[model samples]
Target chain A: MKQEFNITVFSENHIGLLARITIVFTRRKINIESLTVSESAISGVYKFTIVIKTTEDQVKKVVSQIEKIVDVLKAFYHTNQELIYQEIALYKVPTDALYDSDQIENIVRNSGARILEITREFTVIEKTGHKEETQALFEQLNQFKVMQFIRSGRVALTRDPIERLSEFLKERDAFLNSMD
Target chain B: MNKEPMKVTGSEAVILSLLEEGVEIIFGYPGGAIMPIYDALYDYDKKITHILTRHEQGAAHAAEGYAKITGKAGVCFATSGPGATNLITGIADAMIDSIPMVCITGQVASPLLGTDAFQESDVLGISMPVTKWNYQITTPEEIPDAIAQAFFIAQSGRPGPVLLDITKDAQFGELEFSYKKCKKIRSYVPETPVDPFKVKAAAELIDNAKKPMLLFGQGVIISKAEEELKAFIEKTGIPAAWTLLGLSALPTEHPLNVGMLGMHGNYGPNVKTNEADLIIAVGMRFDDRVTGKVSAYARDAKIVHLDIDHAEINKIIKADVAVLGDAKKSLKMLTDNCKKNEHKKWLSEFNKAYDTEFEKVIDKDLHPTKEGLTMGEVISKVSEATNHEAILVTDVGQHQMVAARYFKFKHSRSLVTSGGLGTMGYGLPASMGAQLAAPDRTVVAVIGDGGFQMTIQELGTIAQNKLPVKIVLLNNNFLGMVRQWQQLFFEKRYSFTELINPDFLMITKGFGINGQKVTSRENLDAAVKEMMDHDGPYLLEVVVEKEDNVFPMVPSGASVSHILLEP
Candidate 1:
């Protein structure tokens, strides 16, 4: 069964790392739904949050393969239930649509979106939610005369009761110390 | 770290680091981007020798051949841009086959990076997918550690090629260099520790198995665990079959050794894979060629996979018991735990299939009555001339399958050819590395006329080096393998598989190499002998029947047991 898996990879801030990681997916013909890279809690290391729809077997294999890369410290995959995730999207609509005021205001308020800026030419709205939810806001705004819109790739945090990176570091330190 | 309190150029550091790693010779070509390193190399003439290959691709393949033959990491160098891109194929070849190679390509000056300067390309970007790990050195200081890391990564853990793209400025810059041999990486685990529990479980399965068989690959040789595998098999008295890379690990004539596996493999091994009660796969990826119709492969068997790479486990065939570790250690543990026993019934089944294949396929091919000189007879003749001891480096096609099926191995690492990638032009250049690494060994490169033409320019490297490598050309005027498939499945439509012609003997002579062409079966044996007897490189072209096809093939997508002996 194909289920959406959110895979988080932690690695060094190395050059060509993104292209390298994506090749693994491209090799397997697995489509990435969303991807975002950002600085992690660890100093000098970065995190890659990637979303893909695949079987549990495939996702496990992909994670293992990704971790095989030299710079990658670790990689893990989780179901949607295991991650607290959100996608942020911004919509730009002509100010003329906001001129009506009542309908646009009601839609914005009902959809839990924020008005980032309003100008004589256009109004910009922001929404932070699940991909489908943010996409719903774009759809509602699309009914109006929307100028342009864009959605940021997914950002995620695992809903882990135990801290993984700390434990991993502790284990790493013990292993290294033993070598001396 | 080196205790010398002196400064050195980055190019000198590169040479020093390679020397520290015990690299004696490198296969490479000098160009604009790498001239600094070549300059340093010019002074260190006593320390290291570099063979200037005609093409970067040839250098890369030669390095792979060297590594494969010597069981050491092969080194090669090239300038960036076209030189680096030229290496991409060989890099991919090494990656897929688990050949250990350290490739250093010189890049444009650091400032010129990403600016589309002359001979500048994103080599780090290009080589990443093909290499086990790759790094760029923009400054002289980083060269030592990066190179140390590159060597470490290339030779350790499921070995493959690693690339270091050093900028020209870095090579020219001066730095107070100190060399630290990287013994360990914090994140990299060279050896995946063998699980005692899994080893115990695996031994129990081997003990309980009634019709157990040991299937081993090049991993046994890679881990230098040949003795461990032999002990395990001898103690267990199990029938063993080999993957292409695994050919020379165990003596082919060993009593319990079965035969090859995959397409164009023997009939018995393929049939018995389904019959065996336990399938113990060690050090081989279950590639599609090996596991034809995986659904039917070893269906009745409880599969036990012992491999160093964890990712390989259950990637294709699901293992009921997975013993993950270095082959030497894991096989040792398993050997210590296994009991002495024999699967006589299983052994007999393999022999039965072998006898049938020998009669139907082996006999006629090796001893032919057809007017034209057959490829099989030629390889068989070469095997005889070399006393089955020569390193048989073969290019891809019907000749490759024929060589694997017919040419025997008398020692470990006797066969050096592209197995996983099946790269066509691998044989001729690879022989250069194999011969350079083991100058005492007689290297015979058996290539098809078609594949030989692909990288035929490598003749320059061989002649320039004055290396003695016997080149056997099976001249059939078509790409035999694809033509066979077309003939069988596509109704005898040869298509564009036919080649016009080439006076190979003249071409080889032009390169100042001894050469001959044998048309009759009577002259075949003497021609092979002459090629082997030559003091330097020799090319012997034996014109064979054009439409001849290799059989005992499991048609694509079919079960291995359902092998077609003849079309």
Candidate 2:
């Protein structure tokens, strides 16, 4: 069955590593739904969170290939049930609309969103939730006319208590030490 | 740790780094961007030998050939822009075939990068997908470590090509240079630890099978585990077959060796692959060509795949038991765990199939009574004359298949051809590197008319070096492989597959190399003998039948068992 998969990759922070990781997806014609990169908890190591709608088999192969990159320390894939993920979206609306209706404030409250700032020209509202939830908030605000909207790529963490990369590194270090 | 770094120009540091890596020969073409490196090279004539190829592509292929023959990472040099772009094909070719090569291309000055300066190109971006690893050095201090990493990565694990793009400024700048060979990288693990449990499981599966088949490829040669493989085959007495890249890993006459496997491979291997109870694949990925239709390929068999690359496992044909590690260690472990079993009944079945193929196809191809010369007979003749010991480097085409099928190899690493990429012009330049690497051995390049013209300019390199490379040109006046496909599948449209005229002998003479042309069967033997007897490089063009087809073929999208003996 085809469903959403969250692929997590840990690597050394190197130039062009993002392109290298993305090309693996491009070659296989797999469209990435969302991608996020940031420093991991470990010093000097980077983390990549990529979301794609693909079969389990395809995702397995993709993760294997991603791990094949020289700089990639390790890669793993998980289902929605296995990960805690969210996307932050921002909405800009005309400030006149906010004053014209109390419904806009009600809609914002119901969507669990907060207004960041308000100027005479526009009002900026920020929301952090699942993609569908953010889209729902945008639709409700679209009634009063949303001037602009933007959403960040998915940021996710596995439900597992320990960081998989650290475990992998420890095992690898042990092996290397044994070799010595 | 106590050694002090000596101040030297980056170009000199580059040369020193290569020397530290024990690189003795470099194939390259000089240009403005790389002039500094070449200038530094001028003073080190006694320390390092550089061969100036006519084109950057030829240099890369020569490096590939050198690497294949010497079992070391071959080094190549080229300038930026077009020079770097030209090496792309060879780099891609080496990448696909897992040939270890370190290609150093010169870029414009650091400030001129991305400004579209003269001879400036995004070599790192262009070569990213193809190279095993690539880095750009804008500072002189980064040269040594970058070059060291490039060589280490290129030759480690599943070997592939690596590119290092150094800016002109870096080459001109001076730095305190001290070489430290890279012993390890925190992120990369070149060797996968072999699991004893998996090896035991694989051995159990192998011992339990009634009909077991061993399929090997270049991994045997790359791992230098030919003896281990032989022991494994001998202990189990399994009917072993080889992929094209795996051709010379085992001697052709090895009794347990069945034959080649794939589209135009031997009948026994193709048919019996479907009938086998277990398939032991070592260091060879199940390429589409080898596995006809994957859904039906070895459907009844349990596969045990042993490879260094984990990505290759379950990529095509899924293995029931996956043994991850170098084939050398894994094979030895499996052999130790495996029991002695002579599957005499299974052995007879392969022989029966071979006899049928020999009577039906091999006889006619090897000893044809037809009016024109067959590619098979010419290859057979060459094999017989060379005593099956010469290193055969072939270009891609019908000629490649013919050479792979008909040529006999008595030693490992005797065949160097572009197997995965099927690069057309690989033969000529590769032969030069092969000869230089193994100067005592005869390096014969078997090239088709279509492929020969692709890299014909390489004749200048052979002429300049006076490298004793025997060239055999099989001129059929057509791209025989595609023409055969057209005849069988496309209703004989021809479609620009036919070539006009080229006086090959004249071209060779113009390049100052010995040449001959034989159009008749009566003159074939003498022409070959004369070409082989010549002092240096020789081109012997043999005009064969225009429309000859390679048979025992598995048609596109068909099962391996559905292979046909004739068109």
Candidate 3:
């Protein structure tokens, strides 16, 4: 019953909000495989895209609980099929290893990666793909003594373009205006 | 910009907001950081009654008792550092038990927040893990909104404790105060309206089931849905059981109201849970105490969990039909669609275990057998003395379980005890709150000697206020519950459970309250009567059997059916 889930959370940026949000997941003993927070299209609202391996039931409850936090505007869980997602990974290898090597270029081309820079000490290659693909490219280049490697957490866009949180805010503003 | 509102100091805002919220009483202790609010309180003396408890913990428990009994948010006040830390236990207790409390803790000036200022601590940070929600107010402007939000969060959904930590500067600062009650939040929605289809489906399931049972919890009283629940039980003729907090929800005398269901619960309900075809749980979470060993607990029963919190729906036992909404509305909906059917066979099965339990445990316990001043006998005596109408606030331990088992209630909200938290020192101060909340009723605090000493300082609060709360310290000279566990499981290695005593009567006398000690069972009835009768706060310590254990107990982590009928 355990499958990959992408939990998307929209919230107002507040001090200690991230700590509070992480505490929720920590208390539930749910591991966050990858988590990324960034400014959303709506001004002042931030979006957190978290990848968690859990059951659908667990994901639903977690989303509902996350939504309970005062700063969280809305939270939702989605399967990979419902989200267009990708992670960008950067690989740094010794420049000497790539010296006059057509093999390094062939590996980069096959993995859909491109060299961003070639310094005196290292060459940096950036790859944009699913997690498995990035890991695969890293394994293929391991023989060249990669100096450093880093991968960004998943950044996702939902299948539907219509934003639910905006609608909610519109309704809330109407209510507040009516009260005035 | 909007028109500026009339100006008031932060302390004034707090006072006005409390008045607006209809808070009649508060339990608290004064200190330097909270002086401004206390001073403001003095000016508005006519609007509120604040009982200065001996300790912050007592104040917290007292607030809990008030909230539980009155179905409103109980308020408490504390100063910075040690004062707020002392309230930690009570706050955690309130949180776990779903008791609504708005705890206001005063902090040092905002500028000195992170600095180690005099009597300064990060109370908001310390209380976050334990509280349902918390807010820190830096100015008077935040007082109205913060307090409103605190109350709303504390009382809504699965009600729990919420703390407001206000800096000292805020209490002294002035701001334009226009108080607006928080009816809704941008994100925090407490009530998720029930689905009619889900309710109908649950009703249909109930209508079709042969052996239907209802397990009610504190949510009934919390939601004020006792009548709706009663109608549901009467309509379907299903035998209903109670979680500890659910004890007084259905009158003990009701035919369908079977008995308690937990580790120290009755035998009938525990055993019958496994055999029931349909288990309709309302308002109560499937706590581990209620469902002994999760794997073996009601495995055959098709569960229909109706609760306000959606997260609790399938957290434990998977609900075959989940009806998520307020219990009042959900019960009404379920009741409207169900067909009336008499489950005589199912009812008789419960009777069989009752017969077994009565002969094996209840009969011997309630009626004494030379075990001097048996706990059950003392409770029976108290029940008789008060005509079964008193508000019983019991502390946790053997005494609490014994009092809960024997004390008969005529109405709901009559028994207030720490169920989920199981806090040991809750009785005395809670009794004060109970008496204050229901001024006419006799509030008896049945506590163990160990638990009694924990908050015995509250006797000062009682004496000062002249609140007529009867204190029954069941002096076993041991942490009796843990001792029972030690005896039963740890090869009778009663390590460190025994207590060196002080005379409770003398202690009570020191607090300027009447006191009595009864060792002989002969004086038990008279002593209980005297305490209940002449009590403008009286302490009666009854020395009971030290080695006796509460029976019909399902050993921890075992199935309900594995309950021990006798030692």
> Which has the greatest lDDT?
2
Candidate 2, pairs of clashing residues:
none
True contacts kept of 2: 0.66
Per DockQ, what order, best first? Answer: 2, 1, 3
Per-residue lDDT of model 1, residues B1-567, tens digit only = 666746999999999889988999999988899999999999988989899999999999999999999888999999988998999899999999999999999999988888999989989888888999999999999998998898888999899999999999999999887888887777677666799999999999999999998889999889988888888999998999999888888877888889899898888888888888999999998888988998988999998999988889999999999999899999999999988888887798889888898898888898887787788999988988988888989999999999998898778888898999989899999999999999999999999988999899999999999999999999998999989999999998989899987899899899999999998988877777778778899999989998898978989999988988999
True lDDT of residue B400, candidate 2: 95
Model 2, span B288-328: residue lDDT tens: 88999999999899999999999999999999999999999
Docking class of 1: medium
Model 1 segments more than 4 A misplaced? A93-108, A117-123, A176-180
**Candidate 3 error regions (>4 Å):** A1-3, A54-57, A79-82, A91-110, A114-125, A136-148, A160-180, B1-4
lDDT per residue as tens, model 3, A35-111: 99999989898999999999998888888778777678788889999989999999999888888687898999888
B422-535: candidate 3 lDDT, tens digit per residue: 998998888888889999888888999999889989999999999988888899899999999999999999999999899788888998999799999888878887887794
Considering every candidate listed, which one attains the maximal TM-score?
A: 2
TM-score: model 1 vs. ground truth: 0.97
- Local lDDT at B122 for model 1: 89
